[model samples]
Target: MTSPAVPRQPLLDDAIIALHAPTQAWSGRDGDIGDAAIDGIYHGDIRHIRSVRIRVADSSIETISRSIIDAATVEFGSVLRGLDDDGADPKVRLIRHRALSAGVMTEHLGLHSHRDVPLSVAVTVEVAPEFAPMQDVKAGLAATEPWHAEAIAASDGTPGRIEVRSSDGHRSFVVEAAGAAATVADTIVLRWDIELDPRSVVEIGWSATLTDDTLVVAAAANSEIAVPSTDDPRLARWVEQATRDLAALRLVLPDHPEDAFYAAGAPWFFTLFGRDSLWAARLALATDPGIAASTLRVLARLQGTKTDPATAEQPGKILHELRSAPLSLPNEGVHLPPLYYGTVDATPLWVCLLADARDAGMPEAEVRELVPALRAALTWITDFGSGTGSGFLDYVDETGHGLANQGWKDSGDSIQWRDGRLAEGPIALCEVQAYAYEAAVRGAQLLDDLGEGGGDELREWAAVLRDRFRDAFWVTTPEGRYPAIALDAHGAAVDSLTSNIGHLIGTGILDANEERACADLLLGASMSSGFGIRTLSLGAAGFWPLSYHGGSVWAHDTAVAVHGMLRSGLLAEAREVAGQLVDAAEGFAYRMPELHSGDSHDAVPFPTPYPASCRPQAWSAAAAIVCAEAYAAAP
Candidate 1:
């Protein structure tokens, strides 16, 4: 059978975005939507409105400036010199302030006339609702078929409303415009006629509420966490911007509303993801340990309960992702079920995060309540996890349609040898072993704390894994010796000097000298791009500045190394990597994308953007917290 070809995802590097949990709007920088591939108002995995355009009926207005107020708000300034006094300076101004919240979006349009005479203006707003599923939109298969929108007559002393529903009737939205006449054609048009006195301003607003009957995630119930500030203005601004983005990314399971987790990212993954959530919570634990507690409980609720090859679920395993429907990307050969459990590290990382949360301040009763889950997860670590018979925690996609590489880099092209050949699975990643080793050691501590048995056995298991890893995974590169990216099915080390070895440093799987060696290797010029650590070293054949996993600089990936550098007492190394990330953050306006080009700062002035990268990514945004903590600790 021929393999399916991968389709290009829509580019969003320049799109303007406004977001709140369960709601996000994408538009052109000029404040118009419907033209770009990624432009839409999305609510709970579906795009409710595809196009929203505003025009002055008889006057030409030029957009002068745009400002992002916050993650959930934006303002656009336009000028209508045609309607202004005959002067060099434009006297007529139009400002559109847009704000978003859960399932709702509102835009306040203000028109100010500084002219000396009365002015009459006709403003027309056109809205088109496609009701396209997020997957289709992401795949660039947006809905083109005509859909009907009904205009409801103005009710007692209220403006008229436009009601739109999906063809299947599973989703709907209502649009209301204050003091405007609404009409339905191919698109819903709302028009307002205003007579403004000289030196006066008039403001009109419109709002929409989108509804989806089948939503697994909802807006978080708790308030935003307290953000830490710093004396360093650069670091403070990065943290502030990241904190705002993180606050907008919070989500909760509808069934358990009190437990909240950061959604993975915007425009695409705005829902629960196991590995993403675990790492994000771990990174942000310093800001709010409560989120870690909540994230643990949320994932535990969806813990795998049975062996299923199709969905990749096994007993006590955490799910890879949760969606209202199956996520099928045939071009990429991915057909994950709604509740897939394809991740290999999430289970171990879950254990690691649990221990960290306890140390940070999770309540004793809450920790005890999870003892049963904790035990089950530990059992899974030994049984299904290590049962690959490789004496390591490894993964192989039994269903060819599932993910090929189940590590943090789940891309099919992620795991490659030094020669750029894809490694065959059941492949064991170097970092996963570290995560499992840490999980075992940490799990034992948790058991001991709660007076549970098997603590000794768990530690012994970790010791054995650590010893095996020491002898088997390390490969000698020209620079020095470091752990290979993974061990292929033939048990040959995949000799690609990657950032994976950095994760070993403070995981208890490596000794003091070994940790120092790994830390130095990561800080080497080949691995450190002066923007952040490259996923693949520049010496590797697979290295491409923009390759998704081969050589791109992932903020979270670098933050993971920074985290370990701090834990391993490599303070200077940690500070260097943290500084690179802060510099990269500034290049992206402090809202770190999912990943960026590994282009060296020596070659380019700033880090180049991975054009299609997801902004406000959960772990990427949380990386700011890690950097902040590193600065606070090292300083």
Candidate 2:
């Protein structure tokens, strides 16, 4: 069999126009013409507008500078130059300001003339709507089918307003221009003519509104939650960026318009995710428990109700992810059904999030109402999660097309033995057991506090599981004793030293001595990249600094380890790791991506950006928040 191809970097430049608000977002390179390969406006997982190009006198303009003002605003400055009558340079500068909110994008363009003569310029904005699925767009594929567009006749006898309707009639948007001579030149082009005298400027305003009532209503009701500030400037900036990014990522579910939960990430995974949302919400609990509350409620409502192998759904199991459109990778034979429940950890993580939210001051009445869901989730852990009577939370892909490794490290090659061979079916990940143990203990406490019985049974189960995990998973390496990454189908320990053991800390699955050993290993050279903890150790057989999950340093993973260490009383180690994360965030302009290269910090002064890593990732953004909270609470 052919070896799997390594992931490739995006062809688009890093400098791009990206503005997002929950379910709607637009990302494209900073060019006069939008590249169909990587530029589009997406809504509900569908690409509504594929290409947007701005032309002046039939020539594409070159960008001089670009700046992102906030989550919703970006500004680009470009210049159009042509020889004057004297054959000298006559620079014509164009300033484009774009803002997004409520699924609407408004652009303001200003033309400035530098020469001492009047210049008449004909500017046109070309747009195309593909209505393509977001999955294909992210994969850098062109639209497979054509989407027809028809210009809407100007209403109120005004030519400044232009609207386009999709062929299917399910989607439509309007573009309006003001303070310039504007008209529809073609089915997909809007033209503006303006005359600017020497040293004078003429400005035009353009607005594109996606006619979605649900998005409009949600935007109006959404309010920003304030993140606490600290004396440390770096930490403060990290917190601010994380807070803004989280707010931008918040999407209002169609069923629950009043409440909001964060979509997974931008460019891809921008939808309700069972594990990612639960973890992001949990990390932000100290700032606002409402996020966790809403996320739990939404996931509870969507919990699996029956056995469906195609989508990997099982009764009482939390969903892995939900997408509005079915995704089929081109020629890859991998088709993702709308709903997936192959995750073994999300159910326990859901219970843990409930407990964390309650501790973070979620209202009692709301907590009480979720008791039934909590019980159902616990039942899932006891029944389906402990596959084959292994006394451990494990997972095996029921469908051949489903994810092979269903933990947070869901990539196919993520779970491997020390000798670099892939682990087989019914694999038991170490962190999944930690999550299960934590869920049981925390769930028992929540139940007892709420005057509900059955706490004793859960506590006993947790105790037994913890002891069994310690006996079965722990293995001594050359460096020290740490939990194996996972157990293979043959019940042999997959002895790859990885960041998975760090997750066991503070989860109550490991004893004090074991937690200390794990902490030491985390801070040691094998695991620590001086930027963040690598997913796998450097000495491991399959270690690849740039690999997606094999050795890349994930911000959220580092944050989790830091938080765990802090809770386990490893103050020095916690501070060191947290400080490294803050430094890495600075290297990424305070907007940390999903993961970065695991190159040694001494070898590379800055965190290496993982090609195609999601920026403003839900968990990555929340990592700063989690670290900030830990710093503030440190004694």
Candidate 3:
């Protein structure tokens, strides 16, 4: 019998990422691009440059050091032993500095010589471009056919330029280099022959500008979140590092340039995502409510206005994701339209963020402007959220090609029974119910504040949801009583002691005692990995440290629980989890990834990296701000 083919996915554990909104560059720690699967200069969902290398003829450069200066800048230092004068100290060095912007990537190469005599060398920059779509690259598919750039004659005083175009001419880019001769062969080459005087440095640079008309996101006008002052250096460093990453992730819709939201993450999800952007904005709300306000506006502009099964769009629904083209994963049986609306929680979360943003100092006028969208989203919550007649907010992928499980844990195996069985859909997740109840109550208060009237009805609706959730979602195991992860198709609780219960805290769906019960369960041995809360308890049959949502630790997930604990006045519990997040942040060098293994801290000195996790993920980076705020609220 033939074995089933293993899915091909790229590993990014060692890849260094630099990004500024729609443009990102992935390279090795030594700053060389194109050898690894994910190494490339990508602009607006297209890989513009596949490979980049710096070569010195007759001498080998040994990379000795690498430093990430900021979210969009990296520096590498290399020594040339063959060219160096014979001495204990190296006399010749090469420095490479790289930076990224909206659609441009710039690199400056500096060669320095400390020898008493002058040194002459030939330096060549080899570059190759392959116009591969983001999804194609992500799936580990073979690279699209390679394309060569055409040399554009240098005009007076300006740098020589070369233009690269895709076969379809839909995407293109230009390369410009000053004081260098350009040639096109097997690879595009920019050559410089220079002589460095004693104790002097010679520098040359080249820039690439990628152009794609189909892009929906652009670099924000300003991307700054005020870092909180803290006496604890660890908290300060985490916030500082996270602020830079969050700034680079900020993006604005081209049509709504004034409204800025965060792109989900790099190498894959570098575009507006409803759930991710909403949660990121919500998590960082204490530091900057303006971003939340703007993010609400961005998503509101794209709010669903009609029902479309193919894209999972329904009237007033929030979108799941936005991409330049349809994302199709044949192996996974997943196909998503550019503006799919498959999420179960983003709509309610949107309302929750809107109310929270207002409380966090968003301008009254701005909140007022979103009232219509708010009302429509509430309508969606009532009309379509429970369309499956599940008596709770639920999601089912009717297209069979969309996400099977539609909560934050969208993996197919995410909604599972405690005994390792995958739950059948239409799944009503416990956390979605909490988010919906909170949104209804908050939306009611906002409508009353705006004199729109409907506060009482909304409150009544929230009460019903809370009661129903209390009665139907709770389950008991040898581990004790807590809410189940979700309800399966037969109205039976899929009893999995998972992090979904963590989100129920402070949502008003659970009472004080219930919230405390959840806090205790989360801190217990099976669920608390000492690094952060695990998605699924270690004792669960389906638990695996590296499983995407089965038993992994997502920084954002822990932060959400921490935020809820703080809101519910569970200060001690909040601090405990927040500190664990701080430890995890330090483990990842203060730039958290999308998710990490749920390995016990006692077993591993540090949290293990989930090999394919995307670093600088928007929500994960924003988690730092939540942790800092939790620590700061130490009364």
Candidate 4:
């Protein structure tokens, strides 16, 4: 886990609020809303569950236009080279978006990249008849009115019209007051700016029925009623906050403005990155468990199901990431990546997650029915993943389009030689081996319990993994300390004594002694930070708060480690860490993003937030669930 110093913001009150505070005044500034803002608050304990739902769905034409007002003007200037002619991955492209009520003109800033525009960037507006112009908003909404307008709010005599941008630059809309109680069923139009050339407008029309709990606030946006949404009312605040925080992660990839992003820096990352999707699914499982189930099914169903040396894909392996880009460079002779499958961790981790879904309350029996697919993934790991079967795992991208290290420290030089020189792949890292061991053990459990065939074989395979892993990975020093990070194919230890050591939780392969040793290392003074735990300990040579993977304090990773500690019966320790994390979250406005930095314990009161890591990341957002598990198990 990486911990960056958190920016000082008004933290959520520490006092526990009753579940039914209807007027739980939403805190925090919609500071950025002058452009388009979203605000989500954590409603702890929604029906006594570890889940949260955000209340930031804007569906008012006035609100939408007001959002657009923040935007001066937006230009869609696209360039497409004919495919295979001279480096062109040319495809269709079309772009249409709403303009804000009154601020800057978006025309100055052109679309940046090839990433698709997202749904979050749209101005959320209500299309009710009263809100909309005299024209029937419902009929127009149902039968494709494409345009409407309304003048309301005895206050702001200025009327608001919902404009739907056509691919050809035509704008049509129905005017309506922002946030008028939905007296009639309405549809919200989200403009899809097709960045890929030849992009045709396959109009996406969607209408949602509003329930009583669904508040239509003109001041804010539409958010689902807390209790009924996620089962536990306590979780509503967090869920709402997580949903609103999703906007914080939105970025306008250079060639791709006018669309919401879910990328690295703020004002951009709104596109659906595969990793982000997986994380969102995990957290959504708590609130919108349906999303979690569907995300898994979707990813698994669309998983790279072929094993070809050229693509580095194994049958039934879930992909690391995917993108729909026509302007992307050709992969055969270039470093360009339309969609890269370089991550070695996603596969085994996916299996474990599927298995975990059941434990978190999904039906294991049902997940087990996908036996053949699971077996295919297991094969990919032991066979192709091993590359050179030393019982350890290593990934040298066969296609070279994928990542270099392939694990979380996926950046180049991520995996290193003992002397701090980068290690060459087929490099086997300890965590990957742990993931393999955990997945196999859990997979076998799912199989055996479900009366699946080869239960014996499954157990046997897991046993072999356990035997080899303990033998090959552990090294005892004179002071009774073994190396932390594992070695690459070269047999040299890539020892960087840090919290990557904590990733071994749930492997079930660590014996009591090894578990105890690892736990000691984790809770030790050097490894643990004031703000949760650091990715790499503070003293390691490679340690840096901002370093992508090596040193930042990631919430999800630490949550996993805390769970690992709880698993080993260190209840008090687990509770402390979990509490600290919740406390740390308060500093970051109570919503955990990918990570923060822990530069110094004394550094002015809080962990400095990583400038713009993906906020509301799935695992980070879902850390509360993990924390809840540890909390429930704590002594």
> What CA root-mean-square deviation does each model show from the true structure?
2.3, 3.2, 1.6, 17.8
Please list the residue runs of candidate 3 whose C-alpha ends up more than 4 Å from where it truly belongs after superposition. Answer: 1-7, 146-148, 154-159
580-619: candidate 4 lDDT, tens digit per residue: 6776777766666567876655564877777545444546
Q: After superposition, how far is residue 100 of candidate 1 from its true place, in Å?
A: 0.3
For model 2, how does the per-residue alpha-carbon lDDT over 434-490 read when each residue is reduced to its tens digit? 999999999999999999988899999999998888788988777567899998888
Q: Which of the two, 2 or 4, has more lDDT?
A: 2
TM-score of each: 0.98, 0.93, 0.98, 0.61
Cα lDDT tens digits, model 1, 609-634, are 99999987989989999898788888
Model 3 lDDT per residue over 1-635, tens place = 99986657779989988899889999987788988999999998888889999899878989999989999999999998889766889889999999998899999999988888988889999888888887778778847665657878666756579998888787888989998899887778999999889899999999999998888788999987788777778878889998899999999988888989988987788888999999999998877778999899989999999989898898889998998888987667898988889999999999999999988888889888999999999988877899687769888998889999899999989989889999999999999999999999999999999889888988998998888888999999988999999998888999989998999998999999999999999999999999899999987999999999999999999999999999999988998999998888888888999999999999998999999999889899889888887888856
**Better by TM-score, candidate 4 or 2:** 2
Q: What is the lDDT of residue 298 in candidate 3?
A: 89
Flag the better candidate by lDDT, 3 or 4: 3
Model 4: number of clashes? 116
Which lDDT values do the candidates have, in the order given? 0.90, 0.78, 0.90, 0.48
